[model samples]
Target: MAWELATSCTNQRVVGSSQIQNEAMQIGRKEIKLNTTSRAYVDPDRINELKTISSESFDLSKLIRLCEELNICFAGECYLSMVMLTRAILDHVPPIFGSSSFQQVANNYSGAKSFKEAMQNLENSSRKISDYYLHSQIRKSESLPNVTQIDFSNNVDFLLSEVIRLLKK
Candidate 1:
C-alpha cells in the first residue's frame, strides 16, 4: 500500500543493510534494532483499554507505579514507557499536554528529524483535540486555553534548538 511504502521511507531508513552496519560501526552501536520485545508493543488491547478509561476513574498512582516498574526492568528502552504515558495523557488528562517536561520527554524519543518540528506537529494535533473537547463541553462560557502559543513559540523550540546546538559541538 501507499501508506506502507511512505512509512518505510521515513528518515530512519538506511539505504542498504551494509550501509546500516557501517553507520552502526561508526556510531559505535552493536545492534540494529528492528523490533523491540517490549510487553507494551505486544499487548495492543491493554494499551487501548487503558487509553479509554475516564480521567476521573483513571488511576494515575497506579500508572506511575507501572512506570517505575518499567523504568527499573526496561531501563534501556525508557522511551517505550514514555510513549505509553503520553498515550494515557492524550486519552485522559489532555490539558497537561504541552508542558516543558512533556516536551523533554518527547525530545528523548525523537529520531533524526528536528525536534522542534515534531513538537509543533504535536501542538497542532493537540489543538484539533482541544477543538473537539470544546464542542463536547456543556458550559459554553468556559474556553479552552490556547496552549499552542505557549508551546511552539517558546519552550519546545528553545529546548530542541539547544539540544541540536549541543550535538553540533
Candidate 2:
C-alpha cells in the first residue's frame, strides 16, 4: 500500500525523479497528483484522544515496570511505545523523531546499584529528551508557520520555516 501510494504521488521521492515521473505517466495518461491534505483532515475525536493521552503525567517507575513486563528492548518498537507512554503522562513531551528517552532510562536502570540511582537516571534522561523536544523542535516549528509553502528561489529560509512548522506539531 505504501509503495503504491509513494509511486502514485508526484511529491514523494521514490528513487530517481525522472523515472518515477515516467512510470507514473506510463501507468496512466494523467499525471499522479499529490495528496497533501492528509494532515489537514485530522479527526477531532482522535485529536481529543491524543490530547487526553498526551496530557497525562508520566511516572518513571511505571515505565520500568512496563518494560519489565513486556520483556522488550528499549531500542525499536519498545522505545516508541515508551515514548507514547511518556506522552500519555506528559503533555509537553512532543513526539519528535529521536525524542524518546528510552536509552537514558535503560542506561540508568543498568547502572543502578540501588533504587535511587535508577530513579535519578531515568529522571535525568527524561528531562533531557523533554527539554530538547519542547524547546528545540516545538519552538522552532511554531516560530515559522508557513512551512508548507514551497519556493524555487535561493531562499532556504522559506523551506526551513516550513520544516520547522511541521516539526512543531
Candidate 3:
C-alpha cells in the first residue's frame, strides 16, 4: 500500500515498505535569505577539533554543545552570552578531570605547567568576568563588553586541547 501526506502544496509519498520517496512535489518554492555578516571569536577549527574526541566512559555532549554555542554567540557579538557559556563550560567539565570545580582543575590537574596556567586564567579571569555579568543589577550607568573585554579564546582552546588529550587516553 502507499500513502501520501500533503501540506501547503508539498507532498510526501510513503511506500508499503515504510520507505519515503526521495522526490517530493512542491507547488511553489519560497526562498529566504539570512544575513551572513558575522565573525567567529573562537576559531571554528578549534571547535572541530573538540568534536573529534569520543570516549565510552565520558559523555562530552554538553561540553561540545557549550563550545558550539559559545562560538555562535561570539560570532553574533553577544558578549554576555559568550561569557556565560564560557563559564558554564568551565563548570561542567570539572568532573571530566576528576575535580569538583574548575579552580581545583586549575590548581590540581597533573598536566603541563602552561596548561595549568591557562586553566588558572580561565578559572580566575573568565569566572570573575562572568560573575560580574551574571550578578550585577541594572544601574543608571552601564558599560557593555566589547570583543577585547571578553576575548578568552586562547585559554579556552588550551582547555579543550587538554580535554581531548585526557579523553583520548
Q: Pick the candidate with the highest lDDT.
A: 3
Clashes within 3 Å, all models in order: 0, 5, 0
Cα lDDT of all candidates, in order? 0.35, 0.30, 0.67
TM-scores, all models, native as reference? 0.22, 0.22, 0.74
By summed lDDT, the worst window of 10 consecutive residues in model 3 runs over 14-23
Top candidate when judged by TM-score against the true structure: 3
Please identify which of the two predictions, 1 or 3, would achieve the higher TM-score against the true structure.
3
Candidate 1 wrong stretches, greater than 4 Å: 1-113, 138-169
The window of 10 residues in a row where model 2 has the poorest summed lDDT is 145-154
**Mind sharing the TM-score for model 3?**
0.74
Clashing pairs in 2: 56-89, 57-89, 58-89, 141-164, 147-162
Taking every candidate in turn, the Cα RMSD to the unseen true structure, in Å, is 17.0, 18.5, 11.4
Off by over 4 Å in 2: 1-81, 87-113, 138-169
lDDT of 1 by residue, 19-71 (tens): 32233345443332223322221123332333344554234444433423322
